[model samples]
Target: METISIQWSLVLFTALTGIAGWTFVCVAADEFLGRAKAAAFPAGIAAFVLAVVGGLASVTHLSHPDRIMGALGHPTSGIFTEAVLVGLLCVFVAVYLVMLKRGASDGARKVVAVIGAVFGVLISFMAGESYMMSSRPAWDTLLLPLGYMLTAMPGGVACYLVVVAAKAKDAQVGEYAKALLVAGVLAAIGAVAFAAAAGQADGAALGCVVAAAVLAGVVPAVCGALLPKKPQQLMALAAGSLACAAVGIVCYRCLMWMVSEPVANLFLNIL
Candidate 1:
């Protein structure tokens, strides 16, 4: 049996990027739907910074970080697609921020937000697709990558709500509460579906995946339903939701290795 040895760098990359990407989409929702604009600028900055850090962590996994951009030359590779998507995410975020600073039209900003939201969401999917392999039964499915993307949304919504509550007084977040609940349910369904796809080969792997599903899905759903109106309490709920999402994401990474040999180690051997 292969041991469960998760890659810390990849963990950080996936978790951070997932959160960042989802947060951006939430922020974009605020822009497109015309919600609380007070936290929009700072929230966008937070998402952008988180993504940059996650991108850096992703490169750390490679022996030749300096040549990482060469990935773009191999368009057929999932990794190459992921790299390009992340780049597009950064570019979109930067342009959106710049337009905000220069007082661009609402229509123009919404256009940027629409584009940014698409790239932001897709990066997580590509990240999971990059890791897909036939050797690992758990990894060889669309559900895993879809789980990666769906599971990330609750975290993103929580992070965005945190900023909204923290930065604004008496912030109105009833609509956001609904978003959190929806994200949580989707996350739960996705996680469990992925685990089910694995066909119960091991106790530990199934345990991790199932537990992650509950944590990532149930907590946010409950919190969102009972979301406090007070700013501080709302912040607390949001923080807790984000933490649960993080734990779920990291556990999924552990599940990847628990079910099969360390794929990263295989690459390292080749190098």
Candidate 2:
């Protein structure tokens, strides 16, 4: 397999986006449950800030960062459209945090919760399309978006479960942990199916598939299953699995960048 320099910017952006999205979802969950802890505020703030930074880094990867606003103005540009949606979602999250700090009424918080869920789904879809829209055979799949959403949900829940586990003596962290584990497993399965369906028969492509399978499938399953025994260990496991998933994503992107369409009849002429 030929090694290429991975785009560190994309990697950073994707990783941070995963973490930030998880944070935002956790905060939303806390609000939904009527939790008024100060820790929720800090998590929400961090998530909002990180999400904005991640979105900004994504723009910097474009050839025309200055034209980003114009890209958003274009109706046909899916990438730009997604970027705008994510930006809006981040703004909403920030505003939601502000309202929480100000002791917003239940009715007002509920309104924000509804909006957050909508934007959360939108952001998840856009994140999936970030890879799925690529010409690379390895990434262009309907399952990509669903898998991204699944993976993100667990991460978000895991973060929330951790905080709740620490603070609430009577809280059932096991339920959240179990939910996260299940989501991770489903995402891993979807990712594996996508890789199998799209992978080339060549050595490089085969190597990529094997690497992705180990990282995205096997590792996560084993680690996720161990969550019930040790909560702290489970947290570490979740983090490790998430990291592996991120690496698999990067590798998948690299493979897509490297692979090219097979030329017809050229081999016949050579023969």
Among the numbered candidates, top TM-score falls to 1
Clashes of 1: 0
lDDT of 1: 0.81
Candidate 2 per-residue lDDT, tens place, 25-82, comes to 6666656665535556666666677677878777776666776676677676565666
Span of ten consecutive residues with least summed lDDT in model 2: 262-271
* Estimated TM-score for each candidate: 0.92, 0.75
Error of 1 at 44 (Å): 0.5
State each candidate's clash count.
0, 0
Choose the strongest candidate by lDDT.
Answer: 1
The CA lDDT of each predicted structure is: 0.81, 0.60
Encode model 1's per-residue lDDT on 179-254: one tens digit a residue.
Answer: 9999999988988887778766468887788767777888988888878454458878888888888898777766
